[model samples]
Target: MSTTGAAPGLSKAFYAIIAGVGGGTGRAVALRFARTYPVALLARGEASYADVVAEITRNGGEAVGVRADVSDEKSLAAALEVVKGKFQGKGLAVGVFNVSSPVSIKPFLETKLKDLDQSLAANARGLYNFAHATLPSLVESVSANPPYPPTLLVTGATAALRGSAGFGVFAAGKFAVRALSQSLAREFGPQGVHVAHVVVDGVIEGPRTKGYIVEGVEDGKLNPAAIAESYWHLHTQHRSAFTHELDLRPYAEKF
Candidate 1:
């Protein structure tokens, strides 16, 4: 364990930071990262991450929860500063942007400007701010030769690829996010940052989706823990063969 930024005693242990944490995927990712490094979980409300943080800390892992709105740059910046202060000299080993844009499931003709604006803010603008804030540290981390590549993982959905009916606003935002991820991968990969976009194409198995019935398959939803394992794999991948984009879904999921 490291004494926070202010102290002369630096632990030499880097930290993993995650944005848009919640009870499902966010909690799983935080726990996965906590196994190796101090973890910072960021969400809009303490309720979203407090329990996860406590569980990590209780298990002898260093964890911190910060209330942050990814869509708001100032708030996101403040939360990141907290992360830096907590892990001070240790470089950032990984940064994950798991924010899902609010979906407007309405016909294109019925979609409003505000819905599109909200989606763009949460998906595109939020990622823009997050990358700007984290990349410098990630690049600097390259010199330290951390255990794995300094990675930035973005969470995407099927909307990132096809603009299906009734999902125009969501698709637009996800497409923009995918564009950002592709561009960032090119710009930063040579600089030692592993930027990858993960498209989760099916419904996730979580408390929120207990009632959602999937046709023929039993327990066919994607497990958040399994998704976390994939992310860890991405972080550990060799620089020689970096993955720019990856997609995951249940075995029963349709293309």
Candidate 2:
């Protein structure tokens, strides 16, 4: 993504919503978007989003952190209500589904059925609820003529494309997210919404990945800030040239 200035005269009434927010990629994304629009960060608990929210606010950006569990429809709906209350008459400029379920890597024979169920419930079903909750607002934003297209972005992983050994459950869920994102893109692009799936193929450089070591390669991990920049670029792309899918990885990483 180029070093573009802050979005051109965006509708101040519009806000960006990010689900599955935490200290890593989620915090980076929230801060990036808050530069141009009020941002709402959602997580299952306050601890996941409080610091990020405070940081955004301290930087003179509008931010609200809401507790929400996307896996539960009721919880998601209530969170949307909070968003509505915050934005009032405004529409949704961007919606990011970054929810990642806990994945337990184990041999197929050792993996419990519940592991697969947990992955599916959080990744697939959570995104389903998020899409339903945000799409209407995104479609409404189109007519409002915001500075950029209303975008729905899903954060994917290498598992989204390949089910590697010991990662069956994770792959199943990520693959489902990719599929749904594509379907939404096709269905909503003509309606002026940009639905894109982003594959974060390598270990992200953050606290969570601190122990992930690649000998002799200091830059082998993807930076969350850089990923957020890419996401911003996707949101700002013109409708005439929308990207439905994108992948991010470290240059040192092999395919």
Candidate 3:
């Protein structure tokens, strides 16, 4: 998205910029990419970034931790710079994971406009800025690798589409995120950039999800790692059959 700084091995391997890297989904995605490509992990907290980088590095994956708050445009812009810097600052990179976490766990009626605004900032505005920041890197992609343009994976929830009485605002924000992804898919897909949304049909089970859900992980609950695999599939799938949206839930999850 911003000026790519020079870094070795950074530009050659696939470049993945993951926002909210401190969260469960960011961690999973970072680990998934670290296996084969260099990854930049973005989050508001520096400690989480350190932990994620250490985890990935310990596991033998290349990763760098960046401190950035998606809610702030300037912060997000810097994170994109980190991506380019990894490649020795010359070439473009592929992939962006815009996984935002809900700021609070409140019922629909009890939810405040401020909370909804926060979600929009993190989920929608954040996506916009990140996409904008990475556009240059995506556009300058090398033909040899034929990298995907800003392949963005937006995390969505069942309530985003189904809608619950107390989830109107959250659902509204997610709905907007879904729409943005679709718009980008149509506008950017033909250009070699892929945009997608994942409707996590049921609850996501992890430490980040513990206090946010009514029930904890069940026997048949979806695994975060497996969900990461889905992203991998979408990332590598031939541009022809690119799935713009996917629904993933456990077998026990109701349609």
lDDT of each: 0.88, 0.90, 0.69
> What TM-score does each of the candidates earn?
0.94, 0.96, 0.85
Q: Is candidate 2 or candidate 3 better by TM-score?
A: 2
Could you tell me the TM-score of candidate 3? 0.85
lDDT comparing candidate 1 with the true structure: 0.88
Evaluate model 1: give its TM-score: 0.94
The regions of model 2 sitting more than 4 angstroms off are 1-5, 8-11
> Per-residue lDDT tens digits of candidate 2, residues 1-255?
212346754347789999989967898999899998999999999999999999988998898999999999999999889889988998789999999997678888998899999999999999999999899999998888787889999999999999999999989999999999999999999998999999998888878778687545988888899999999999988788888899999988888
Q: Each prediction's Cα RMSD?
A: 4.8, 2.2, 5.2
Cα error, residue 113 of model 2, in Å, equals: 1.2
Q: Tell me the tens digit of each residue's lDDT in model 1 across 1-255.
A: 211122132225678899988877888999888888888899999999999999998888888999998889899999988888888888998999999776669988888899999999999998999999999999998888677788999999999999999999999999999999999999999998999999999989888888776657777888999999998888888888899999999988889
- Residue 219 in model 3: shift from native, Å? 1.6
Model 3 agreement with the true structure over 140-250: per-residue lDDT tens digits: 563435433346677777756766666666777787778887888888778776678888876666785565533343445667788888877776666667789998988
Which regions in candidate 3 have their CA more than 4 angstroms from the true location? 1-11, 89-93, 101-109, 142-144, 147-150, 208-217
